[model samples]
Target chain A: MKPGPFTYHDPTELADAVALIGAHENARALAGGQSLVPMMNFRYAMPDHLIDLNGVSGLSFIDCGERIRLGAMTRQRDVEFSSDLQHAVPILREALLNVGHRQTRNRGTIGGSICNLDPSAEMPAIMLLHDAELTAQSTRGVRKIPMNKFALGFMTTSLEPDELLTEISFARWGKGHGYGFHEYARRHGDFAICSAGVLIEADSRGEVARIAIVVGGLGATPVRLSAFEAAAKGHRLADELIAEAAAAASRMDALSDAHFSADYRRHLAGVLTRRAMKSAFERIGVAAYV
Target chain B: MSVNGRTYERDVEPRMLLVDFLRQDLDLTGTHAGCEHGVCGACTVLVNGRSLRSCLMFAVQANGASVETIEGLANADGSLSILQECFHDHHGLQCGFCTPGMLMTLTEHLRENATPDEQELRVVLTGNLCRCTGYQAIVEAGLDAARRMRAKKEAAE
Candidate 1:
């Protein structure tokens, strides 16, 4: 398949790219072209102008400090192999290993995945786990949007037409915190039928001080198990407690498709969540009962 | 872009895929195009030393970048590279439609990872689909190639 005809603009500056998108009525920003180009070839997206962001400067970087900041154009492969990210957020690398294959990851970008907002994508769910704040830029100005409020619906984001996602920043979990991510897909590189991401911080007394659980591929957007997180805090991660959280995850709303039923997805959600929680507990020196 | 050690200059349409540019414009037909929507890795090539699906990228996207295709995998004197020879010894292909893509993918994999286990090779190969040979022979070839390359590097050292 071939993409439909359209004028292409490769702006070398961030402001120029933002101006182009803001000026054009139907212009789409081209990040790594991992997802956008495929959609264009399928005729699902036929933007009249393509604002290529590859040439833009200062948009492909990784800054690690109190909070980790990643440029929108930071390639997924880079993120997967970044030593800083692995040390700060090991679960990101673990989850990225399941995001498509090596070839796709070489060109895919963090911003592209978040903007695409595939319900089964690992990046969005991981972002949700970290409570990331995204920076969006436009001709008007820049604004920060919390990850919880970014996704509007299925494959749709709250991003305005003219806004360009610039950077994503999230506070890093403490050194002793443990994180785990799990995804189940039909094929090795396919999007997950259900995915789970867990981050847990244990207090000096070996009890859960803070926990964030995110279940993806079950609904229009990744759902945070806030109720479970609140209920389970200050408690040890026993097998029964993990099972209860998984049960709550399975009862959440899910979308059914031709290949998978909602009930099947829900079942997978429960199984994956349990496994993820167990792994997280084990990482933090807690012995989860079989 | 510099492709296969040669720099080429041409004006292409914005919609023209890199695979089409290589085949139709430069006549580098060894890089086959399959499932142009990026699912099948038959159009995979090295751009800036990283393996990427050529079909997913526009021709202009390769501006000033270096690309390597199947045509460049052979020795400069026209003999097959050690990896291709390993494929030949292990019978890594049947119909040979996916050979180019598989070879290119494994080429990059072996370059970065001097020694990869069977499971790692199999996982890396998931990007390229091979309907024939059941992937067993391909995996064997990859392992064999890795061994040979390691030996060669040791000898050189």
Candidate 2:
């Protein structure tokens, strides 16, 4: 047995779910339960009422329009296998594959993953790099939140109790695109001690137009190093320049954990940034942050 | 809520984890709880088609949900699927503790990707932890099954 006794309610409609959350201040919206379930088991989270959102159907589609709109309830496995996502945001699809193991990914939702907001998570870095916008709903109505502001701290997000994440949107990346999502964990499928995600865009001349390098799992939230991005503003991809940029990027934030000390994480940050940027450059030669 | 297609709608303590609920309350001992935390996947189950760690989930969490344990992997006749047959052929299991969870996950995987590569197979079975066989036999079993499965498809076509 765990901690608090809670009432369970599965609302079929979005509005009903929002209303239930609004009414119960301590209620939680359960998406995949990959994180929430374990927390409850450990008595880490004591939600009075559990608002299970599995009944909210059709909320797990990856729609490609002006922006890639991924329903908040979409599972990590769903995103990993999405052909539409593979064609559009290949980086995200690749990143989705990096989330935990296949079994966890099968039941872990993209929204739920971000909502849990583990610092070393790959999805949040992907979202931050793409400048993804999150749609949060409540009894008061809906609000569009940016990636930077969405993730607050370790296992912390800006999402209010009354608000449920409805969708995550980012400008689509077309074909002929290159991408890479890289992270270093103690073992495969374990939480990354340090991770890096890179996204780059080219101009009409095919020169580098945009560069977004995001590092997560090493901070309270995904942190984008502006100094490093500035280094890549207009120059072509070069090794020395990339190394300098990665060093500058690593200087921004160094996370500390028992397994990996702050200095080690800093070293990992720079190394991963270099590798991620190289692979990404090799791929768009390809791909951000919070 | 029911497990392995068996229904039990009695009142239970909120603190009881779904894994314990299945093993102790329901008496379906196939659902083994390894590493009470989420690290080990030995306690994995299909909670509404998605494999999740039962140790991490509370019994109340599955109130409106459907969960499939190792006991539900086979048909009513209790015959093993081809996936299981491949495991046996490849000597995939050693201690046989992680076999139930591994088989459940691999079965679902083959259903989706009949032809999975080595890398794909590795990532797919990442959740289930095994201390025996060094995973070569299990991964070999999955790959071997994929080849046979593809050949069967080609023959049918």
Candidate 3:
């Protein structure tokens, strides 16, 4: 399986890369080449030009400030290993470890993962959980899109052909924030069958102060359960409340494929949601009814 | 590209994957192309001292990068490397199709974590699949290699 012939452009500058993608018709930006290359080999994608972003500078970095600014080209392995990121947003690390294998992570970039936008990919779910923002650049200018809006559908994004995903940023959660991420896959490195990402913050009275719950591999994109969040808001951590949240998740219109039935995915979604909520509450020292 | 400490220069197609460039053009066939889609990890190679699936990368992408294939894993004196020796002593391989990738993956893992325990080694080897031995001997070999590597490092220090 060989990728079809294409003209390759390795631009060292961000502007040049943007220009290359803009000027070349049917051009695809090659970041980690993890997803695109495999698709190209299968002839699922055949771009006439490849704008290689590997040589682009300033697109692979992590800066901690009021908000965490992650360059699009930052490798997944770097995110897993970054002490700063682990301290700032521990759930990012938790989710990254579940992505692909160590070798793939070494070469796979964070931006590439988000741009790939696999419904089962952990990065999109994590971003959705954090309300992350993505910066897309083109010759015209730069525009920021929320992670929820950035991902349109399976393997589809709002990014135009000429635009490049340059950076992703999310507000840093304050101290006392507890995060839990869990995914079930057939194999260790395989894509998730059903996964859950949870963020929990409890008040002094052990009541829910802030929380975000997003489930992946259940739909075309990671689905956020706002109804569950609203229902659990201001409620004490209790078995009934957790059960209600899980029930709400089960009602989502989860996707059904040959490997998993819609009814089963609905069941697992509830189970995983309950598990993630329990783990998140436990991390905050609030005993959640398992 | 300087592969295994040897330099070679040639014009190649932009879409030519690194695995094809190595096996077909350079005659370095040790890096097998099992899945050719980055799942099997049989085409794993060291690009600039990091393990990468050569099948997922273009030759032009690695133009200035130094590469290391299975052919480079042996000692300069032509003896088996410590990791390779451990694999042999522990029967880590049977069909030997995935051995090159397993060695390349472990080489990078050992370089990072010189004293990885059995559990950690198993996690590291999850990317490289081995069907023949059910991975018992491979896990043992990885732990043995880490022990030997750490001991040698301690002696040098």
Give the top-scoring candidate (lDDT).
Answer: 1
- State the lDDT of candidate 3 residue by residue for B1-157, as single tens digits: 9999999998999988999999999999999999999999999999999899999999888887899989998999999999999999999999999999999999998888887888898888889988899999999999998899888889999
Which whole-number lDDT from 0 to 100 does residue B12 have in model 1?
Answer: 94
Per-residue alpha-carbon lDDT of candidate 2 for residues A1-290, written as tens digits (9 for 90 to 100): 65567888878888888899999968888888878877776778889888988778767888988888999998888788788778888778767766778777777788988888888888888888888899999989899999999888777889887899999999876556545678888888777888888777766565567778888766688888766677677776556656875786678667676777778888888888887777776776423220
What are the C-alpha RMSDs, in order, of all predicted structures? 1.0, 3.5, 1.2
Model 2 segments beyond 4 Å from truth? A174-177, A204-206, A285-290, B1-17, B47-50, B56-67, B73-80, B145-157
The fraction of reference A/B contacts recovered in model 3 reads 0.81
The lowest-lDDT stretch of 10 consecutive residues in candidate 2 chain A is A281-290
What TM value does model 2 have?
0.89
- Chain B TM (all candidates): 0.98, 0.89, 0.97
Task: Flag clash pairs in model 1.
Answer: none
Q: Give the top-scoring candidate (TM-score).
A: 1
lDDT value, candidate 1, whole model: 0.93
Cα misplacement distance, residue B57 of candidate 3 (Å)? 0.7
Residues B8-123, model 2: lDDT tens digits: 78678766788899999888899888877777788888877777778877777788678888888765688876677789999999999998788778777887788789988887
Better of 2 and 3 by TM-score: 3
Candidate 1 chain A, run of 10 with poorest lDDT: A236-245
Stretches of model 1 off by over 4 angstroms after superposition: none
TM-score of chain B of 1: 0.98
RMSD of 1: 1.0
